[model samples]
Target: MDSANSKITVLYEAPQPEEYLQLRAQTGLSLKSLDGAKIGLANSIFAVILRQEDKLIGMGRIIGDGGCFYQVVDIAVDPAQQGQGLGKLIMNEITTYLDIHAPKGAYISLLADVPADQLYKQFGFDYTQPKSLGMYRLIAL
Candidate 1:
C-alpha cells in the first residue's frame, strides 16, 4: 500500500501504553519499561496518527513540568508509513498545542536524532550552542 495516498488521520490523543511500546519498537526508538511508560504517559500531551483501517502509524508526545519546560519526545512513525509526511503532521499538532498552552518565555525543546533535525528545523527549532548543550544519562534498572 502506498502510504502517501492512503487516508491518514492525526489525532490529538495519547496512544494506549501498549500501543506506545509497539510504535516505539517499530520505529527504533528507545524502549520504555512498562511501569515507566505508564507513569510518563500519564503526564504527557500526545498526538497520534492512524492509517486507513485505524492502524496506529505514528505518535509524538510533549513531556515536561507543564509550566516552565516542555520537551517534545517519542516522535515515531511506522517504518512502512514513513516518508509520507506523517512526521510533519505530528509536529504540526504538537506545535499547535504549544502555541496555545505554553506560557510566555517557556522553554520548549526536543532531541532530534541525526537527519531528523532537519524536519524539526522547519518547526523553528534551532541548535542551542555556544551557550548550552543537550545531554542526558540513562538510569540503569
Candidate 2:
C-alpha cells in the first residue's frame, strides 16, 4: 500500500499550525507553540506535504541557511497511516529540493530517530563521521 501511487499532492512552505500539530501528534515529537507561531524558525527551508484528497497525511522539512549548512527535520507521517510509503513521498520531495538548491559542498545533516534511517538513506543521507559530533541547544522561552 505504498502511497507512492496514491494521489498525494505535495506542497512547499506550508505554514499551518493545525497541520503541524497533526504531524507532531502522529510522530510523537515534542512541539509546543507560543502564541500563534507556526513551526517555521529556519531562515531557509524545504517543506513538503502529502495530501490525500484534501487532507494532509504526511509532511517533512529541511532547515538551514542557503549556502552553508542544512538539517533535515520534522519528517512525520500519521501512525495509523504507516507502512504506506507516504514518508517516502515526503522525503523524495525534500531530497530533490536539497539536491537542486543546497550550495555545493554544503554540509547536510539530520538526526534519524530510529528505523527511519533506512528511508533517509534512499535520499543520500547518512550518519556523521566519528571525528565529527552533533550538538543541540534547546530553546528556553
Candidate 3:
C-alpha cells in the first residue's frame, strides 16, 4: 500500500518496554518480565519498526556489548501485518546498523524460531550446525 493511503512509517526508535511487551505478545514472541525488559531494552544498540496509524505494526532490535557480540533479537510483526515485508524492513535497518558499527571479527548471532530461520537466511545468516549450536535456558521465576 502507498504511504499516503497506508500511512505506515518506519522509525529507528526503541519502543518503550510496555510497547515492546505488547508487540511481543501480539506477534507470538515469548513474553519477558517487566524488570528484565527494562534492563534489556536499556542496553539495546538499535531498534526499528513500522507504525501504521500510530499503531506499532512491527519491531526488531540489536542487543549486546557494542564491539564483540551482537545478537539480533525481538524481531516481531503484528499478525495482521505479516507477509507485508515488515520483517525484512526491520532486518534491513538492523543489518545496516551492524555494517556501519560492528567491529571486524565481531560475532553477530540470532536464534531463529524454526521457519523464521528461512527469512533470516536471505540476509546472510547461516545455520551454525556442525560447527556450533544455539542453546539457552529459562530461569524459573
TM-score for each candidate, following the candidate numbering: 0.90, 0.83, 0.93
Model 1 accuracy (lDDT, Cα): 0.84
Expressed as tens digits, the lDDT of each residue in 12-63 for candidate 1 is 6777788889999998888788888888888785555555567788888998
Please tell me which model should have the higher lDDT, number 2 or number 3.
3
Clashing pairs in 3: none
Given candidate 1, what's the lDDT at residue 66? 87
Q: Report how far residue 28 has shifted in candidate 3, in Å.
A: 1.5
Model 2: how far residue 9 lies from native, Å:
1.9
What value does the lDDT take at residue 104 in candidate 1?
A: 100
Residue-pair clashes per candidate: 0, 0, 0
- 3-72 per-residue lDDT for model 3 (tens digits): 4348688888888888889999987888888888888888889988788888888889998999999999
Candidate 2: 10-residue stretch with minimal lDDT: 34-43
- Per-residue C-alpha lDDT of model 2 across residues 38-137, encoded as one tens digit per residue: 5363333777777666777777777787689888877888786788777887887887888899888999898887799898888887778697777888
Write down the worst ten-residue block by lDDT for model 3.
1-10
Prediction 3 TM-score vs. true:
0.93
Report how far residue 94 has shifted in candidate 3, in Å. 0.7
Q: What's the C-alpha lDDT at position 28 in model 2?
A: 89
Global lDDT scores for all candidate models: 0.84, 0.74, 0.87
